[model samples]
Target: MFVAAEIKKNTYYDSVYLMRITKEIEKTEGVIDVLVGMGTELNKELVSSLSMMTKEIESLGPNDFFVVAKIKREEIMGVVTKKIDSLMNEKKKNNVKEHSPATLDSALKYNPEINFALISLPGEYAIEEAKKALEKNLHVMLFSDNISVEKEIELKLFAKQKGLLMMGPDCGTAIINGIPLAFANEVSRGNIGIISASGTGAQEVSVLIDKLGSGISQLIGTGGRDLKDEIGGITMIQAIEALEKDENTKIIVLISKPPSENVAEKIFKMLNNSKKNYVVNFIGSESKNVSNSKTHFAYSLEETAKMAVELANKSTVRNKEVDAKCKKAIEELKAKEKEAIASAKNMVGNLSVQRKYMRGLFTGGTLALEAMNILRGRGMEVYSNLAGDERFILSNANDSYRNACVDLGDDVFTRGRPHPMIEPSIRNERLIKEIRDEDVLVILMDCVLGYGSHENPAGEIANTLNLAKKDMTNEENDSPIIVVSIIGTNKDPQNLKESIIDLENAGAIVVFSTAQATRIVAEITKSIGEC
Candidate 1:
């Protein structure tokens, strides 16, 4: 392989754009991996992690734009570099073809009605850009992560006082005025509105709503940290107010991976005063359900969407077909789990191959939380970095406990790098390590698809899974079962049918719903019975 670096002095692009550019270029033929960004210590560290680092790259300053990649041949280097240039040119080509706005103020001059600005600058500059947008009377979606909690509270409070909504400092998904933004779906607009601190959490519920024959009215993303004690649920409360006053919304759904106790109480107080119907899916929270004729509690994302749709349509009776599917799913899991247990016990006592417990390496944080919750519900002591009892906290994200689920998208794992959704290389790098453990009976995962995610997510790890199986078979141990939940639709850029088939072809059990996959994992754990 060959490593190539391109240095363009005085050229600058925000980190988010660079992330997307790198992903697209990596798809080119003969390209192995890629790093595209301004040359800073963080970028250098990221490129180095992929073994493409060099003294020249390390010497680059923040002002210099760099394209670093590992290619199969020296000749492909030119093609890859040309592709990067073409991509940059394409990004610079705006629809209006006027002078590109140098400042937020100048952009506002071009179109005064721009009430929403999406900010993805570096964290240090995120606050200033957000303030500029707020001053211009525009609601903001801050996609940049790493902004301090203190700054978040300050900006959220300022936006609240001005009566404008601010989505996130690390917000990843939202839909407003019939348009999808930042890791969202293309579901039709209807009467159900969502307020979420979780990115993929909101995406899951909204997409499920679409599948349920109901659609979303709007989705307001409260950046993942909005519900912390520091932010005090500012965007969430603001969104609730906005949705309540909007004539289009008739039902409200709140999605999050649990909130602070004080904040949940504050939200519950707000919920009591609201007139619309409700379906609240607060994963991993011990909060009790409070339901009236209009309010309902949902324990899972699938249930949340179903309840919200039924409330929107005033349906009181559950469908017999749905009940039958549930019964069938439970039965099938039971039978398959029984067979798995027998196979494990009868495998010639190859103690070297006796698989024990489960390990989850998830790219989407919410899906990981969902899996963790389901496992815990099944009486399994599951440890996770993002959600769980403190005792179950992962000592180090890289280490696995009895039953461990690591959110690869967690801040620690993705620090100084792109999200797994943007670049699954890191997850792939780690999955190889996890699969080598014969004690791991099964590996559970989720493949999330939609706008602003990998174009072919399943394909990223599909071939590698086969490699894992081949190696395990060579070791004379049972190959770890790969159970996956694919969250996507036919309309996604990564064709859903192809993605599912890719996994299935690689000896994976691909489930359509995340909830089902989690239950299967729980069942397998129970059947395996602790090694």
Candidate 2:
């Protein structure tokens, strides 16, 4: 906010106290606060008067306010549009690549038992890739996004015709047999069969179930955005039918974000008629009437998985047993949520072990899915969608992914302009904001290190930490940032540990391996749950 007055030999050009007037500005609709920062000798008296007048005008009426200070509409609009254009470009860049095929021939030459082809290519190219895989008789876990309704229906139908299971086009996550695939959390093998519309929703819940010593029959992802307007629950409809018919599936679990009210009614009706014991989590959706044999409603992904595990292990619950079990777990969980919040706060400064939230900002579809299984065993959430956007996994802004690298054809991690791990400066603000909002509770992160690499990731993270520290308001619980730099001893920079320590000093918890860091989070989460 600036006010300028041209002085010509004391020939007073029409004078107004802009600053004083700004101060007198009234609280009006859509305005949160008004601040004035600049004033000069040429217009000191005028500025002072206007500042006072700003405070005065506020008292006049609801909308009345001193209006001497203003910026050119063109300038403001220009800056805003420029920002928007930059963001749009970033988004476009995120989805710019064509579909990539996996380098599976090499994989096959070495590992003949590799029975799975996790298809994560773009929708346009998915059918072709899937056709080739099905010809090879490989089971596919499709994790691609932007798949058309027609394509998905056709592919699923084709897969069925070939006696194969095609997991998803916009699949969130899935675990098959003993393997956690796609954006899935690690879980033990058991009898609960999960069919979910939300990816992270399914992964988190499934992992919870796994952590409880119970296992899964199969955890299936139906793809997020499946129940939208034109789509009309095609995947869910087919999925529920399939799960109901699956002989190995003793108990059925279904999870989704809030669906349209009308769609909810239809889905619930379908569930009501089903014979299997069920746990449902329509996150942010209403709890509807459940009738017939057995049905349970869970509010969150975590709770949904927990509910599924309990149901899976305990069979033929008597009325008395059901009543007692419900009462106990509900009370216990409420207490746990409180303690978890406290534990997260307490864990801030205690750097006994390195913990990380390893987000594989990967372009490689197969690698991302493979990584998910690896991370899942260690209890870290893996997130990436077919469209290359993981809101729950990555930042919301487009620019944050400007440097991200991926290959649609092969689904491999490729480097982009501003690589997220190397240029933490690009993402720290959003990461800090997410932490403040409690959207994440990560202490450290795992970053890949290979051929073409940034010179100093630890140093980059250190600088990012310094910038974040300057911006943070509530420094008490500034989340413990960490990074697990995955490098072989051969590629180790001479000062790797020292560089990591620099990040530690600037406010980061650095580590060496993704596995080790993930274990820490799992252990911590387990501890929190026990508390």
Candidate 3:
């Protein structure tokens, strides 16, 4: 199907040689591939000259053709033909546009109303651009990580003073007037409003409500630091106050990983005093469920959404059964500690949990903080990621925490490898290894599903879990129990449901929200024993 020819003339440039080869091939029949080689009869210099010219000839067409210099004639022929075919196939796959950094920057000038600048540039250039956007009175949605929390707070304060919304220094998702923006889910709108300190927390809440055939009045992302000691819910408090004053909003949702007791108290006080209905989902903390009118306490995102939806419809909370069932689930978890530890990593949302007492690795900052919060709230001693310590410390864990209602877009995680949404194969081994020891019990994660998610995340999870099960069994132990808060649509991709079934079969109890998942696992682990 292909032919190789040796060109010996000194006048032959690769381009000319290719041209000659094509003409020759045209004269021949049944030849699909063409390769030109310079044999021993040709001088090395002439062969070298022909090499450059051959590319032009191939571009014109030979079915596929290649010319190589310096290498042996047969070797050159093989290399050229293979390269040509590969190049052709590559062209067919993705017509990637290669542009210099300057070209990309120039293109930015075209989008003016994009007042909210979301900078995901490397840290070196992000601050300067943020300053530029701020100077231009543009709202900023910062997706840049590695920027210091201090810088983030300063920028947020500056934006606030300027009467503009500055979403994040590591903000990955948001919603505007019920429309899913950035790394967000497609959900409709209603009277419910949200302010989240965790990037995906707001996304999960808003999207869940949206999927339930409702919508949001507003969803403001407070970055992850809004509830931290330094920030103290500055933006969140203001946003809640504003939403409370707005006539369109009937229900409000507060979603965060977890906050300090002092910060939590302030927020609780604010919500307790609000005239509008409010639902709170602090990922790992189980504060007193608000008993009076106008406010409700939800341990999970799904519960919060369910309550919000009910409030929108002027209905009261009628799910005492769900809470009781969740409590019973926690007891079942307590009975399965060793088995859970064998197959998965441990996670904590609160910071008061004794990291040293546990022998597992952690992944979510908020979840870790909540675990610590739970322990401290219950009058137990705990350690935190602060003090710049070597062990039990991480800065950006929430960035990777799985929230079913958010999509972090195809940015950092999707560039060159498999995204978390697509099944984290690379992340699985680490998860299994970290949890394989005798002290770990829980694998905490937020599972989000929607248009941009993997079709079979649950199925993929099950497969990974099955592999982990084999690993655990080989080590003479049972698989770890996985507690997941799954956020997505019953109407999402068909595989989403299948994935849930797969995860269930693989021994994961997948719930409806990260907050709920965290609460269930925490109560379950404490009851069962250290999972």
Candidate 4:
């Protein structure tokens, strides 16, 4: 193997753009892997981890732009470099033809009508940029992660004082006034408003609501850390207040991992005081009754969306009628579960005794957590990087233990690469690795489609899935059953129907909801006596 490095002193590009360039350059025939970024400490560590680090890379300052590639031949280095240069030139040409402002101040100056800023810089620089936007009386959505909790609290409080929405330090999804923003799906505009701390969690529910023949009014995102003890659900509380007064919102939905007990109490009090009916799904939380008549608790994202749709369609009816509708929704969900179990039984005929473990490679962290919770609830000893219980946490995230589910979108996997959402190909290697493992019985995943997500997520993995399955068959090992849940709508940039067709053609069992996919995997594991 050959490793090549190139440095451009003082040159800078946003991480997203760099990731895009990296993805494009990696398509070169001889390239095995690539990293493109500014020379930050984290980037240096990432290069080292990939064994692509060099003395030149070690000497680079943070301002220096670098591209490093591992390739099959030394001659391929020129091809990789030329590809990088071509991509950079293409971006520059596009920028020249468009009104691409380099900084927030310049952007606001060029267009004073801009009232919202989506900040996606490195964490060290994002806080200041977000504060500047908030000071300019603009709503802020901080897309960068690696931010400290203290910084998040500070930003949320300042935005609150300014009476502007501060969405996240790592917030990834939102739809405002019918426009989809980073990692969000397009749905009909209606009366259901959402405030979610989980990006893909929100996407799943919104897509499900659209599928159920209902729609959304607004979808607000509070970054995942907002509900912790220190931050105390600052952004969530503000979002709830906004939705409460929103005339178009007749039903509200809240999604998150279980909040701190104190934070949960505060959120419940606000929900109780609101006039609109609400459903709360703290994904993975035990479903329990709340004191408010208008409040409903859901155990899963599917149930949350269904209950919200029920309330939205029957908002004018009396409490008794609404109760009856919710009960019917629950009954319907139970019926679907029975069908899923039956389907799993039929599918398990292909499984061999060696096929006893389930491996989940998820791009969505929230979705990954939900899968782990569901599997554990079904009495499966699931290990994961996102596992909340120490005993269930995987010691090495890159290696799968018995019945392991990994969130590939976690920072560990995304340090110097695009999010699996942005570059669905990031999960390709991991997917193939799991496929080659003979002990794996089931492989579960999510295809999240939306405005800012990969154009054809399912297509991106289809070839890998095809090749891996063929290899397993050639080796005479039973290929693990691949189950995928697509979180998308027909209106998304990616054609939902085509995406589903591609996965099915690639031999994956395509489902619509993440919960349904998890349930199917659990049933298969149970049939094999592994759970």
Q: Pairs clashing in candidate 1?
A: 356-439
Q: What is the C-alpha lDDT profile of model 1 across 1-531, one tens digit per residue?
A: 888887788888766677777777878899887778898777787888889897788889888899888888888878877887888788878546667778988888888888899988888877999998998899999988878888999999999999998999999998998788989878878889999988888888887777666678899999988787888899998898889898889899998877888888888888888888888888867646354556677888877877887677664246666445445644564575555445434432444446777888899888888888888887888888975589999999988877898899987887766789877878887788877776777788888899888878899879788777677544454556677878877766778899988988886777755676777667666665672
Predictions in order: lDDT: 0.80, 0.51, 0.56, 0.87
Q: Could you tell me the C-alpha RMSD of candidate 4 in Å?
A: 3.2
427-528 in candidate 3: lDDT tens per residue?
455456534543444555556565444455566566777776676444354434567656665545534567677777877866654444545555545553
Best-to-worst TM-score order: 4, 1, 3, 2
Where does candidate 2 stray beyond 4 Å?
1-115, 132-138, 160-163, 260-266, 316-337, 340-426, 432-531
Using TM-score as the measure, the top candidate is 4
For model 1, what is the error of residue 422's alpha carbon versus the real structure, in angstroms, after optimal superposition? 1.4
Using all chains and alpha carbons, the TM-scores for the candidates as numbered come to 0.83, 0.48, 0.58, 0.92
Write candidate 4's Cα lDDT for 221-308 as tens digits. 9999999999999999999999999999999999999999999988888877878899999988765536888999988888889899
Question: What would the TM-score be for candidate 1 when compared with the true structure?
Answer: 0.83
Candidate 2 C-alpha lDDT tens digits along 139-200: 67777665677777676667666777667776747777766664444455767888877654
Error of 1 at 453 (Å): 0.4
Candidate 3: lDDT over CA atoms?
0.56
Order the numbered candidates by lDDT, best leading. 4, 1, 3, 2
